[model samples]
Structures are given as C-alpha cells and as structure tokens.
Target chain A: MATATVILLDGLAYGMVLFIISVGLTVTMGLMRVVNLAHGGFAMAGGYLAAMMIRAGVPFFAAAALATLAAGILGGIAEMTVFRPLYRKGELAQVLMTFGLTFVFIAALTWLFGTDVKILPIPSYLAGPVDLGFRTYPTYRLFLIVVGLLLFLLVWFVIEGSLYGARLRAAVDNPRMARAVGIDVNRLFTITFVIGCALAGFGGVIGAEMLQLDPFYALRYLVLFLVVVAVGGLGSFKGSFVAAITLGVVETAGKFLFTDIAAFLLFALVFVLLLWRPNGLLPPKSVA
Target chain B: MNPAWHALPWLLAIAFYFTAGGYLSLGTSILVYILLTLSLDLALGYAGIITLGHAAFFGFGAYGAALFAIHVNADPLLGLVVATAVTAVFAVVTGMLILHTQGVTLLMLTLAIAVLLAEAANRAYKVTGGDDGLQFTMGPVLGLFRFDLWGQTAYLYTLVILFVWFVIAWKVVHSPFGRSLDGIRQSQARMRAIGTPVWWRLIAIYAISAAMAGSAGALSAQTTRFVGLNTLGLLVSGIAVVMLVLGGTRRLYGAFLGAAVYVVVQDFAAKVNPFYWMFVIGGLLMATVLFLEGGLMEVLDIGRRWLRRLLRGSDPT
Candidate 1:
C-alpha cells in the first residue's frame, strides 16, 4: 500500500510534466495541423538555457522566466520565417522539414554543451521531503502537482471561457469561416504557437529533474509527447490531461512491478490504447 | 529504360571491385542499403503508407537470420530465406494492427510497434546478445566460394541478389496492380468507391516490402557477421527515409543513387567530424523540401533536357 502510494505520486508528477510539454504539440498538430516534429527541440532549448543561467548563479525562478521568454521569442521568429512557409505545405513536407530542424537543434546543443547529460538542480525550497498526514513525500513532486493543476485550470479557462479562446476555437474548427468573420486566424495561430512553445519551455525548466536533459532530449522523448497527444484526441485539452496522467501511472507502475519490461509494457499500452481509441478518448467536438 | 541499360549499374559494380579493391566492403554496404531503401519505396513511395517503423522489419530480420545461423543453420542462403519468412509473418501481424489507423494515429502505432520490438530484443540478451550484439561466422556462399577478408565475394554475391530484387521490383512497379496502388495513394476514397480492396492491398504490399527489407537485413548480417541493437534503432529508420527522399520516390533507380551518396558521404564526413554529417544531412533535407521537391533525380532530368536543347542550337522553335 505504501509503495503504491509513492508510485502514484511520482507518476502524477511525471504525468504533469508530460502534459505541459505535450499541450504545445497538441496545439501545433491538432489545432494548427502543421505536424511540427521539432516541438521538443523548443523544450530542450528552454531547459538548456535555464541550466546555463542557474549554473551562472541566477535564481531558479528567475532563470526559468528568462528562459521561457527567450523561447517564446524564438518561437515568434520561427513562426515569421521558416514555419510560416510550412503552414501551406503537406504533412509529409512538414514532417521532413521539422525533422531536419530537430537534427539541427540536436547538433547545435551537442556543440554547445557536449554529449554528456546536463543536470538542472531544483532550489532548496522545493528540494527534500515534506510530511504528509500519512507519510512523507517529496516537496518537489507536490509542487509539480500544484503547478500542473493550476496551469490546467488557467489554460482551460482561457481556451474555453474567454472570447479570445472562442475565436481560437472558431479558427480551428473552420479557418475559412473564421477568416470570413474577420478573425485574423493567422495571427491567432501565431499567438497560440508562441504561447505553446513558451509553455513547453517552462515545462522543460521544471521537469528537467525527471526527463533529463541531453543533446538527444528531443528525439528520445518525442514518441511520448506524440502518444499523449494522439491518445488525448489531438486538439482536446481535457483529454490530454486525462491521457497523460493515465499513461504516466501505467509507465510508473510498469517500472515498479515489472522492471525488466518497463519500456516494452509502456509501448504495448500505447499500441492497445491506440487500437482501442483510434482518434483518442475524447476527440475535439469538430472532429467528433 | 532500354534492355541494355540493365547492365550499366552491374558493370559499374564490377569495375569498382577492380579499382577500389580494399573498399569492397563499403560497396557491399551501399548495395545492401539500396535494397533496403528500394523495399521502403514499395510501401511508402508506391503505396503511400506513412510510417517510420520499417527498421523493425529490418532489425528483426537480422536477429532472425543471426539466430538461425547460430542454432539451426550456418548456410547464408538458408538463413536469408528463414529470416525473410519470419519477418514477413511478423509484418502481417503488425500491419493488421497498425493499418487501421490513419495519419498521426497510424504513425504513432508504427512507432510503438518498433519500440516494443526493440525493447524485447534488448531484454532478451541471452538470445540477441543485447547491447554486446549478436556475432556469428557465415558459411561460404552456395557452399562453394569462401568468405574472404578483402570482401571480393561479398560484393559480388550482394550485387547479384540486388540485381534480382531490382528486376522483380521493376516488374511490380510497372504491373497493373502497381497502377492500382498509385490510384489508392492519389485517392483512397475513389479507389474504395471503385471497389478496390484498399486494406488488403496495403497489407499485401507491406508484407512484400517487409520481405524485401528482411532479405536486405539478412544480407547485411551475413556479410558483416554481426547484428547490433542499433540495427533496430530509429536512426536506421530515419536514415533510410533520408536516402529515399534524397533519391526521389516512385523511381526504383533513385534508391541506388540515394543509398550510394548517403553511405559514401557519411563515411567521409564521419572521418572529418562525426557531428558534421548531421548538419549536412539536415541542411540537405531542408533544401530538398523547400526547393528541390523531386530530389536529385529531378535535377538529373532537368540537366538532360538542357543538354538536348544545347545539341539543337539552331532550332529556335
């Protein structure tokens, strides 16, 4: 029972990180239909920047904020340039182009940081254990859960409860109609893309302890992000949340109970879940 | 192409053997990669099955062939046949599972299957030799020619097999069934409306492609006498796609050009600096998508047209 509780908490924290990173990809592929395979590269960029700042004696929160802002600026520049041309191309072209972009990011990071895994140490406030009523749990994980839940709430409200979000949804549902209504769908998408990449950057800053930062960070964890988005039904935020948590728990449990086949079982779950859901657990209303 | 054109590549291969003597093993690898890329074209270029899991079939074939050599038989031909059969069976099962989904869902399914197989191969260290890799000695080809250090026999044997497969691929690509596959790729709904068995055709072509990839994998194992976990890695799959795109899809000859350039360039670049190759490959991929849509073959076509115009200098019309 004790072990199960510990696994559940760890899994939740891991899932929260996945959700944050994958939500960006969900926006790009699901809402925008661009199939940007380099989304993880942005996350890696943020994490790497934050790592450098912290190593140079910047405070943890300040480092994360600067990294996120820089990542957003980078996204904005990418949008106005290379990615702008790709919005009109086919998925295959997008895939190949973004794959090239990813390779470039990996190569760049390797040159800058060397091939070794880079560490991002959490601040003392969030480090060590905290006493719960029943048992002691890591303060860092509790912070992750709090941050994930808060972000989910904020994102849900912005996307579902605000006029801007309604316009964003309108653009996604039918770009022509949105354009006809003078929505400036292109601008809306650019904003969303920038915000999504920034969130991915923030996720990287906080989740570095779990996912680990390396030159190959983008490629190594790409499938996980894609799986979460696919299982969540692409454009659906709520489904991403649920699917991320479920997969995280399943992966964590597999590691705890069947260490020898942990990765195999995780992949097997992906296969079966996808077979069962196809479009995912909760496809967006337009798709449904 | 004219009947005489069939022997051009073979002639080059032979000439290369005498000229580049010590580099015959590298030449052998180029041939093996060409066959693998050719097989990918059948499913991806011809059938339009968007996937990144082709390496699963190739790696499984290597494992299958290596285990066959270790336990049951040491004859290279028999191992190749066994490996092909095993991989084809595996493809049939996975194709059924993954082909039902479309687009992103489909892509993820294929990736999942590949990762699952790789993980299984990793854990079964006793059988696959895991990270240390599976190594074995291959018997003489057809029980007559002995395996040599200079790779003289390996190059010729691989060239012969590649030629046979290339001919078979040519027939398949030009056949009526191949025409139907073109239809499906262009308009799946139209093909379905016209009563074409879309799903079955996909599975069949996937199996055939898997068989070819398996044979290539088996050949690689036999020639190199080793099968490492990296054989099943995403890098191998990605590199295969890179080669296919570099040459141009739907043209079988493209595989030959792409694989040769990729292998030779990688060999040279790695010697200079390992990371330098990534920049070159990545830049090439971007250039191919952005400006060179039809790849190197398209450039060659344009060059030939220019040459024709140059020959008819006086004809303004």
Candidate 2:
C-alpha cells in the first residue's frame, strides 16, 4: 500500500511535468503543421534562465515567471525570422530546419554556460513533506500536482470556452476559410506560437527540478515530449493531459517492477497502444 | 547515364587512394557514409518514407557483425552477409508495424523503435558491453588480404563493397521496380488505384535499404574493429538525413556527393575548431532549406552547363 501510494504520487507529479512541457508542442504541431524539432530548445533556454535567476537570489516563482516571459519573447523572434519562412515548406524541410535550429541552440547554450549540469534551487518552503489526511507527501510534488491541474483547467477553459479558442480552432482547421471570414489567421498563428513557446518555457522552469537542466536537456528529453504529443494526438489539449499522466504512471510502475527493462517496457506499451490506435487515443474531431 | 558519370566513383576512389594516404581511415569513413546515405535515398527520396530511425538497422548490423566475428567466423564477407540478413529481418518486422502510419505518426514510431533498441543495447551490457561498446578484430578480406594498421586493405575492401553496392543501387533506381517506387512516392493513392501493391513495395524497399545500411554497419565494425552505442544513436540518424539532403535526394549519385562534401567539411571543421563544428553544420543545413532547393547537385549541374556553353562558344562549333 505504501509503495502504491508513493508510486501514484510520484507518477502524478512526473505526468504533470510532462504535460506542461509537451502541451506547447501539441498546439503548434496541430496548428502550424510544422514539425518543430527545436521546441525543446526553448525549454532548455527557459530552464537555464530560471536557474541563473534563482542562483542570483531571486525567488523561485518569480524567476520561473520571468524565464517564461523571456522564452515567449525569444519564441516570437524565432517565429518571425526562422519559422515564418518554413510555414510553406514541406515536412522534410521543416524537420531539417528545426533540427538545425536545435543544434544551434545546444551549441549556443554550451558556449554561454559551460557543459555542466545546473540544478534549479527549490525554495525551502516547498522542499519538505506535507501531511495529507491519509498520508504524508512531499510538498513540492503536491504543489506540482495542484499546479498541473490548475494549468490544465485554465488551458482547457481558454481553448474550449473562450471566443479566442474558437477563432484559433477555425484557423487551425482551415486557414484560408478563417482568413476569408476576417479571422486574421497570420496574427492568430503568431499569438498561438508565442503562447505555445511560453508554455514550454514555463514548464521547463518548473519541471527542471524533476527533468534536470543541462545543455543536452533539449535533445535528451525531445523523444519523451514527442511521444506525449504523438500518443495524445496532435492538437488535442485533453488528449495530451491524459497521455502524459498515463505514460508517467506506466513509466514509474515499470521502473519499480522491472529495473533493467523499464525503458523497453515503456516503449513496448506505447507500441502496443499505437498499434491499436494509429491515429492516437483521441483523434481530433475534424481531420485535416 | 553518361560514360563519364559511370566512371566518376571509381575515378574518385583512385584519386583518394593516392591523395588520402594520411587520411585513409577518413576516406573509408566517407565510403561507409556513402552507403548509408544511399540507403536513405532509397527510402526517403524514392519511397517517400520519412524515417528518423535508420540508425537502428545500422547499429543492429554492426553489433550483429561484431558478435558473429567474435563468436563464429571472422571472415569479412560472411560478417557482412550475416549483418545484412539480421538488419533486413529486423526492418521487415518493424516496418510492418510502422509503415501503416504516415506523417508525424510514422516519424514517431521510427524514432521510438530506434530509441528502444538503443536503450535495450545500453542495458544489456552483459552482452553488448553497455555504453562502452563491443570490440573484435576481423579476419582478412576474401581470406587473402590481411587487416593492417594503416587501413590500406580496409580502404580497398570498403571501396570494392561501395562500388558493388553503388551498382546495385544505380540499377535498382533505374529499373521498373524503381519507377514504381517513384510512382508510390508521388501518390500512394494513385499507385494503389493502379493496382500496385504499395505496402508490399514499401516493405520491400525498406528491407532492401536496411540490408544496405547493415552492410555499411558491418563494414564499419570490420574496419574499425569497434562498435559503440553511438552506432544506433539519434545523432547518427540525423546526420544521415542531413548528408542525404545536402547532396540531393532521389538522385543516386547525390548520396556519394553529399557524403563526400559533408565528411570533408566536418573533418576540416573539427580539426579547426571541434567545439563550433555543430554551428557550421547547423548553418549549412538551415541555408540548404532556406536557399538551396535542389542541393549541391543542382549547383554542380549548373556549373557544368555553363562551362560547356563557354567551351562551345570559344570553339565556334
């Protein structure tokens, strides 16, 4: 029972971090049809920025927020210069270009802040365990779970409820039609891209405690983020949330049960799941 | 094809034999990449399958050859054959599962398969030697030439294999089967409408490409007498793609050209500043996508055309 509880708590926290990091990729891939392999580069940048700020004595929360904003701004710049030109290219071109961008980011980060791994300093208040009614749990993990749920709700409300959400959906479904209806699709793409990148940065800073912050961080966890997006079905917010949590739990359980073949077991699970649903667990309603 | 073009690879090989006396190993490495990129061209350029996990086959072949040489016979030819067979089987099994999905899903599946294999190799250190990799000396080529320290025999052996594979690839790309692949690439639905077995064709091409990549991997292991985890790494797969795109896709000879250019440039840059070589590669890749549409082949073709025109004008013919 104790093992199960610990696994559940740890899995939830891990899943929440995965969701926060991968959600941005899902949105961009769905809307832009661009395989932005460099999405993790933004996360890496945010992580380093947050780590540096925290080391400089700023509060963790404030540093994270500032780092996210910085990431958003950097995303805006990249979208205008690099990504805008690639919107019309084929998937192959997009893959190559974004891949190159990832290399550049990795090299630049290595040059800026040596190759050593940098850990995010968690505040003392959020470090220790908190007493739950049934059991005691780490405060930081509980905080992560709560934050993840809150972000999910906020994102869900904004994407599924608001008028802006409708416009974004319209633009994603048919950019020409959306433009014909005066929806300003180009502007919509810009805003959506920024938001997606910002989310990645925010996730990077917060999830750094679990995922680790380093120069190779971008490429190391790229496949995991991609797995979440692929299994969740590109462009589906709820799908990503569910997939992330499921993967996290499965990964945690696999590690506990089978130490050596945990990665193999996780991949096998994903493979079986993918075989069953080639399009993903929950495909979008309107196919592109 | 022009006679000059037919003799190009051989002429280049001979030229390198004399000029690459010091960098013979680098030359051999380039030949290996040519084989790998050629296999990629078969899949991505002709079959239009967007795969990022090709290194899986390469790594499998390398490990298979290394294990075979260590446990069974040390003959290079036998090792290559065994490696190719192993990778072909692996490709067929995985291709059936992955080729069903197209676009991003296919890419994800391919990457997943490779990563799984890499992780498995990493964990099964008892067999694979973990991250440290497996090392084993290979017997002489054709049971006549002995393995040497200067890599002279290895270079010649690799050159012969590369030439043979080039002929096979060239023949495959020009045959009716190759034309069918082009049709499938242009429009899978159209190919299916025309009663072509699109899935079987893809499976066949993928297996064939895997075999070729496996041969390259086997050759690497035989020559270097070492097989590391990086053999199956994502970076290897990505570099293959970059090399293929750098030369030009769909054109068989582009593989050689791209591999040559990429290897030479990388070697030079690494020697100059290993730390920033990635930046150079990244810049080149981005520039290729943004500016060079048809790759280095197209530029060379333009230059050749211009030179011919200039010669004709001067000759008054």
Candidate 3:
C-alpha cells in the first residue's frame, strides 16, 4: 500500500514535468502545424545550460531563468530560419527538416559534450524530505508539485484571460481572419514558439535531476514527449494537461507493474488513442 | 559506322576496367544499395509515404534468412526467397493499419513499429543473440557454387541480381499500373473519385518495396556473414531516405547514383575525418534543399543539355 502511494506521487511528479514540456509542443503544433522534432532539443539545451551554470556556482533559480531565456532565443531563431520556409510545404518536408535539425543538434552536442552523463545536484534549499503520516516524500519533489500547479494556473489564466492569449486563440481558430483583423500573425507565431520553448526550458530545470544531461537522451525520450502531445491533442490546453498527467502516471507505474512490457504498452496506448481520434484525444475543432 | 564495330571496343574497355580494379565486391554492395534505394523511392518519392522505419524490412529479411538457414539448412537462393516472402507479408499487415494516417502520425507509427521489432529482437536473447546480434554460417549458393570471400565471385553474383531486379523494376515503373500510382501520388481524393482503390494500391506498393528491401538485406547478410541491430537502426533508414532525396525521386537511375554517392562519401569522409561526416551530410542536404530544387539528377541533366547545345552550335532546323 505504501509502495502504491509512493509510485503514484512519483508518477504525478514526473507527469507534471512532461506536461510542462509537452504543452509547448502541443501549442506549436496546434497553431503552426509544424511537428517540431527539435522541441526536445530545446529541453536538452536548457538542461545543459542550467547544469553548466549550477556547476559554475550560480543559484538554481537564476540558472534556470537564463536557460529558459536561451531556449526561447533558440526557438525564435529556428522559427525565423528553418520553419518559415517549410510553412507552405507539405507535412513530410516539415517532419524531414525538423528531423534533420534534430540529427544536427545531437551530433553537434555529442561532439562538444563527449557523451558522458552530466549530473545536476539537487539544490540545498529543496533538499530533504517531508513526513506524510505513512511515508516521507522528498521535499524537492513536493516543491516541483507546487511549482507545477502554479505554472498550470498561470498558463491557464494567461491563455484564457489576457489579450495576447485572445489573439493567440484567434490565430489558432483562423489565421486568415486573424490576419484580416490586423493581428500580426507572424509575430504571434514567433512569440508562441518562443513561449513554448521557454516552458520546455523550465521543465528541463526541474526535470534535469531525474534525466541525465546526455546528447542522445533527447532522441531517447522524443517519442514519449510526442506521445503526450498527440494523446492530448493539438491546441487543447485542458486535453494536454489531462493527457500529460495520465501518461506520466501510466508510464511510470507501467514500468513497475508490467516490467519488460512497459515500452510496448506505452506505445500501444499511443497507437490506440491515435486510431480512435485520428487527430488526438481532443482536437481543436470548435472555433475553426 | 557499323554498330558492332563501334560498341565492341567500348565493351572490351569496360571488361578490362572491371577485371583490373577488383571492382566486384564494392560494385555488388553498390548494386544491393541501389535496390534498397529504389524500394525507398517507390514509398518516399512516388507515394509521399515519408517512412523513417524502412530498416524494419531490412532487419526482418536478415532475421528471416538467418531463421531459414538455421532451421531448414536452406539453400542461399531459397533463403532470400523466403526472406522476401516474409517481409512482404509483414509489410502488408503493418502498412494496411499504419498507412491510413498521414504526415507525422504515419512517421511516428512507422518509427514505433521499427522500435517495437528492434526491442523484441533485443529482449529475445537466445533467439536473436540479443545485443551481440545474429550470426549465420551460410551454406553453398543455390546448392551448387560455394561461398567465396574474394571480391570477384561475390561482385558478379550481386551485380547480376541487381541487373535482373532493375529490369523488372523498370518494367513496373513504365507500365500502366505505375502510372496509376502516379495519379494516387498527385491526389488520393481524385484517384478515389476515379474508382481507383487507393488504399489497396498503397498496401501493394509498400509490400513489394518491403520485399525488395528484404532481398537487399538477405544479400547483404549472406555476403557479410554478420548482421547487427544497426541494420535496423534509425541511422540506416534515415541515410536511405537521404540518398534517395539526394539522387532525386521518380528518376530510374537516380537511386543507383544516390547510393554510389552516399556510400562513397561515407567511406571517404570517415577515412578523412570520422567526426565531421555528419556535419558534411547535413550541410550537403541543406545545400541540395536550398539550391538544387530538383536534386543532383536535375543538375546533371541541365549540364548534359548545355553540352549538347554547345556540340550542335549554330545548327538550325
């Protein structure tokens, strides 16, 4: 019973991080119609940057902030350069180009980083454990839960309440009409991509302690990340939130329960979900 | 000018080059790769099926051949035949279910299928030898000729197989059935409207291509005497697509040209600087995508057309 509780919390914590990272991907794919294989690259860059800064004696929060900013910059540049050209092309070109960029990023990073698994230490402030009546959970893990909730609410408020969010909503619904209404569609797209990358960067900082800072980790975890996005559906925030948490818990618990069959089962779920919904669990079909 | 007299000297020179250069093994590998690339051309270039899991069929063939050889002690010819048959069956089953999805969905599904098979191979330690990979001591060829490590015998075998496959592929490409495939490529909706069974045709093409890929794999395993997980890895599948694109899609000889360029560049570049080969490949792809709109074949065609014009200078009809 205690083991079950522990697994549930652990899964939730992991799932929250996946949620944060994949929400950005879901949004970009929803608005831009580009399958950014380099989305994981942004997470990687942020994790690496945060690790380097932490090793250099910078505070974790400050390092994380800088990493998020760096990711946003990289995302903006990718939008302007690689993605802009493929907007008018087919989905195959978009997938291929992004895949090409992914290889380039992996090769370049491997060349620089020497393939070793780089570690990030858990910050002192968030170190130790909290006693729950039956079991003790890591304090840092609890902190991530709190942080994750805050981020969820913040994103929800901004997306539902703010003017920029309204413009974004308009763009997601109909780009032509949004442009006709004098919204700078390109600028919104750039901002959205940057914001999505920045969220992935934040997820990286919190999630880095769990995942090793390695070159191929991005490729290794890419399918799962995509699974979260696809199961949640594009442009549907609520769907991503629910799907991400569900997948995180299921996958984490699956490894424990199913053992060797975890990966197959996880992928099978993705296939089944896609088959059922064609687009996703909850496609953005209302406004459009 | 007598035709026999004109071609006889060139044929003798070609024979001399093939004999002197020990070009058999290298030439055969090129031919096998040409077949693999042609199979990819049908799916990627013609059908717009952006598959990144093509190595699934290749690995399937390798394993299939090994299974046949180990259990039945089958002849090498029979091994390849069985391998192709198995791969075609697998392709049909998977392609029918997966090919209905378009774009990233299809890519992801294909990738998942490849990863599933690869992981299964990894976990089944006793059967596949797990991470160490599978090994087979191939029996005599066609129950007659013995296996030779020397380049000459191996090269001729592969070259002949390639030539035969090329002839068949050329016939298929030029036929009315192939033209129907072109129509499907342009628009599935229009083809469906015209009463073309788009889905079944796609499944058929995918199965045929998988069979060809499987043959390449069987031949490769037989010649090399070893097969690794990397044969089914993303890198091989990615490179095959890259080669096809570099050579230009929908062009017959383009697959051969692409494979030659890809293999030669990898071999040469690794010798020169192993670390920078990927950078070179990426740069080349970018250049091709940005500048060579129609791929390397288009550039060559333009050059040839220019040369012809220059040779026929001032001649007006």
Candidate 4:
C-alpha cells in the first residue's frame, strides 16, 4: 500500500513533466503538420540557458523565466526560418529536414558544452521532504506536480476557453475555410509554434534536475516524450496530459518491477499503442 | 542512337568499381546505400508510403543475420535468407498497423517503431553486445570465397548484390506492377476506384523493401564485420532519407548516385577536418534544400548538358 502511494505520486509527477515536454510537439505536429524532431532541442536550449544563468549567480526563478522566454523567442525564429518553408513539402521531406535540424542542434550543442553533464542545484527552500504519514516525499517533486498541473489548466484555458484558441481551432479544422473567413493562418502557425516551444522550455527548466544534462540528453529523452505524444494521440492537449501520466506510471513501475526487462519495453508499449490506434489514443478532430 | 548506348551508366559504374583506385570500400558503401535507398525509394518515393523509420528493417537485417551467423553457424547466403525472413515478418506486423493511417500519423508510427528497436538494442547489452555493437566471425561467400581482411571479396560480393537488386529494381520500375505503384503514389483513392487493391500493393512493396533492406544489412554485417545500435538509430534513418533526397527521389538511378556522393563527401570531409565535418554536411543540406531541389544527380545532369552545349556551340547552328 505504501509503495503504491509512493509510485502513484512519483508517477503523477513524472507524467506532468512528460506532458509539459511533449505538449509543444503535439501542438506543432497537430497544427502545422511539421514533425519537428528538434522539438527536444528547444527543451535542451531552455535547460542549458537556465543552467547558464543560475551558474552566473542569478536567482533560480528569474533564470528559469528568462530561459523560458528565450526558448519561446528561439521557437518563433525556428518557425519563421524552418517550418514555414517546410509547410509546403511532403511528410518525408518535413521529417528529414526536422531530423536534420535535430542533428545540427545536437552537434552544435555538444561542440559548445563539451559533453559534460550539468546538474541543476535544487533550490534550498524545496530541498527537504514533506511528511506524509506512510512516507516522506521530496517537496520539490510535489512542487513540480503543482506547477505542471497549473500549466495544464493554464493551457486548457487558453486553448479551450479563449477567442485566440477558437480561431486556432477554426484554422485547424479547415485552413482554407478559415483563410476564407479572414483568419491569418501564417501568423497562427508562428504563434502556435512559439507557444509550443515555450511549454517545452518550461519543462526544460523545471525538469532539468530530473533529466540530468548530457550532450545527447535531448536525443535520449526525445523518443520518450514522443511516445507520450504518440500514445496520447497527437493534437489533443488533454489526451497528452492523460497519456503522459499513464506512460510515466507504466515506465516508473516497469523500472521498479522488471529490472531484468529491457528499458525499451515502455517504448514497445507505445509502439503497440500506435499499432492499435495509428492516430493515437485520442486523435485530434482538426487538421490544419 | 542504338538502344544499347543507354547501358552506358551501368558500364561506367562497373568500370568505376573495378578501377577507381582507393574507392573500392567507398564504392561498396555506396552500393550498400544504393540498395537501401532504392528499397526505400520503391516504398516511399514511388509508393508514397512515407516511412520515416525504414532503417529499422536495415538494422533488423544486420542484427538478425549477425545473430544467425554467430549462433546457428549458418552460411552467409543462408544468413541473408534468415535476415529477410525476419525483416519481412516484422514489416508485415508493423506495416499492417502503420499502413492503417495516412499522412503524419504514418510518419510518427514509423519513427516510433524505429526508436523502439534502437532502444531495445541499447538496453539488451548482453544480447546486442550493448554499445560496443555486435561483432561477427564469418567464413566466406557461399562457403567458397573467403572474407579477405583487405575487403576484396566483400567489395565484389556487395557489388554483385547491388547490381542484381538494381537490375531487379530497374525491371520492376518499368513493369506494369511498378506503373500501378506510381498510380497509387499519385492518388490512392483513385487507384482503389480503378480496382487496384491499394493496401495489398503497399504490403507487397513494403515486404520487398524490407527484403532489400535486410539484404543490405546482411551484406553490411558480412563486409563490415560489425553491427551496432547505430544501425537502427535516427541518424541512420535520417542519413538514408538525406541520401535518397540528394539523389533525386523520383528518379530510379538517383538513389545510387546520391549514395555515392554522400559516402565520398563523408570520407573526404572527415579526413580534411573531422571537427568541422558536421557543420559542412549541415550547410550542404541547407543549401540542397534551398537551391538544388532536384538533388546532386540533377546538378550533374545539368553540368553534363551544359558541357555538351559548350562543345557544340561553334560546330552547330
């Protein structure tokens, strides 16, 4: 019972982090039909940025904010430079181009950082564990859960309850019709790309401690995050949240229970899910 | 012009293979990629399958053949058979699932499948020799020819396999079935409307492509004497696609020429400056996407055309 509770909490925390990392990829793929393989590069850029700032003696929160904003800007640039041109190409070209971008980003990053693993220092305020009758869990982990939930709700509000989201939805549902109706799709693509990268950036800063920084860290984690998107079904933010959490639980439990099994069983699970439902567990109704 | 004059390209490739000093291994690598790329070209460029993870089959071929050689002590030829069988089975299983979707969903499914295979290879350290990769101790070609340390037998063997596949691919591309595939690539719905079983054609093409990829994998393992997780990684898949695109995807011989160019560039560039090789490749890719559009083969064709025009300028009106 005690282990179950611990697993549940850890699973939720891990899931939230996965959701944050993958939500951007979901949006870009869904809205733009661009398989941005470099989506994880944005996360890496954000994490590295925050780490650089923190190392320079800036406050942690301020460093994280700056990093997130920079990631958003970088995302906007990527939108303008890369994806816009690719929007007209076939799926293979887009996949290859984005995958090429990932290679460039990774090679450049490794050249710059020298392949040393950087550890983010957990703030002093959140170092200790909070008492919970059966077991004490780290406060920082709980904080991550809270932040993830808040972001989830925030994205939900923006996507579901806002006029901007309505316009984006209309564009996704029928780009030609939306253009006929006077909605600017090009601008929406840029905005959606930026927002998606911002989410990934946030995940980078917050989850840096969890995902210890390494040269190919983005590449290593990319498949996992993509699995979340795949399992959840692309284009549905809510589906991503649910899928991410489910994958987190399954992966975490697999780590604990089947130490002898290959680590990729979790990925195999996603592969099976994809086979079962090619569009994912909850495919988006709209296609821009 | 005599019809036999059109065979000039094959004659040239054979001459290059025989006499292109210090290019035997590089030529062989190109042949391997030509086979791999042509296999992919059949499915993706011709059939419009959009398989983003085709390297999985290639890796499966390498690993399966390597394992068969190591454990079953099978002949290299038999190992190729086993590899194809395994890859075909895997393709049928994954293709059935992946082919259900259209567009981006298909792309993601392919990526996911490849990543899963790579991850499995990574995690199964003992089985796959882990990051160190799987090394092979092989006998020879068909139990007759020995694998020379200098890669002589490997080169000739790879060339023969490549030529055979190329001829097969060539014949198929010009056949009725091949035209049907092109029709499907243009519009699947229309093909179905015209009484073609679009799905079955796709499965058949995917199976054939898997067999080709597996053949390359077997040949690569036989020649290179090693197979690693990198075989299934995104890098391999991405590079294959890059090579295909660089060659002129829609053209039959484009993949071959593209593979040759890509391998040569990698070899010479890394020798020139290892530190800047990636940057150069990235820049080349960016340039290719932006300007050439038709790939390196197209560039060569244009240059050849210009050269002929220049030579004829004063002689002809």
**What is the TM-score (0 to 1) of candidate 2?**
0.97
Cα lDDT of model 3 by residue, B1-317, tens digit? 23453344235424743684665566667767888998888777777777888899988998888878877875788888899999999999999898887766677778778877877777677888878887878877767677776655555556666666767777777788788889988898999999999898889889988998898888887777777777777676877887887788888567876887877777677677654666567667656655665678888778878877987896765
Q: List pairs with backbone clashes in candidate 4.
A: none
**DockQ scores for all predicted structures:** 0.80, 0.72, 0.43, 0.47
Between candidates 2 and 4, the one scoring higher on DockQ is: 2
- Please give the lDDT score at residue B125 for candidate 2: 94
After the best TM-score superposition of candidate 1, give how far the Cα of residue A113 lies from its true spot, in angstroms.
1.8
Q: TM-score for every candidate vs. truth?
A: 0.97, 0.97, 0.91, 0.93
TM-score of chain A of 4: 0.96
**Where is model 2 more than 4 Å wrong at Cα?**
A133-135
Q: What is the lDDT of residue B230 in candidate 4?
A: 81
Give the top-scoring candidate (lDDT): 2
Give the range of the ten consecutive residues with the poorest summed lDDT in model 3 chain B.
B1-10
> Candidate 3's error at B299, in angstroms?
2.3
On DockQ, the leading prediction is 1
lDDT of 2 by residue, B1-317 (tens): 45886787789788988898789999999999999999999999899999999999899999999999999999999989999999999999999888877888888888889889999999989899998999888888888999899999999999998888888998998999999999998899999999999999999999999999999998898899999999999998999999999899988878888899999888887787665777778888899999997778888889889988898999965
Lowest lDDT sum, 10 consecutive residues, model 4 chain B, at B1-10
lDDT (C-alpha, whole model) for all candidates: 0.88, 0.89, 0.78, 0.81
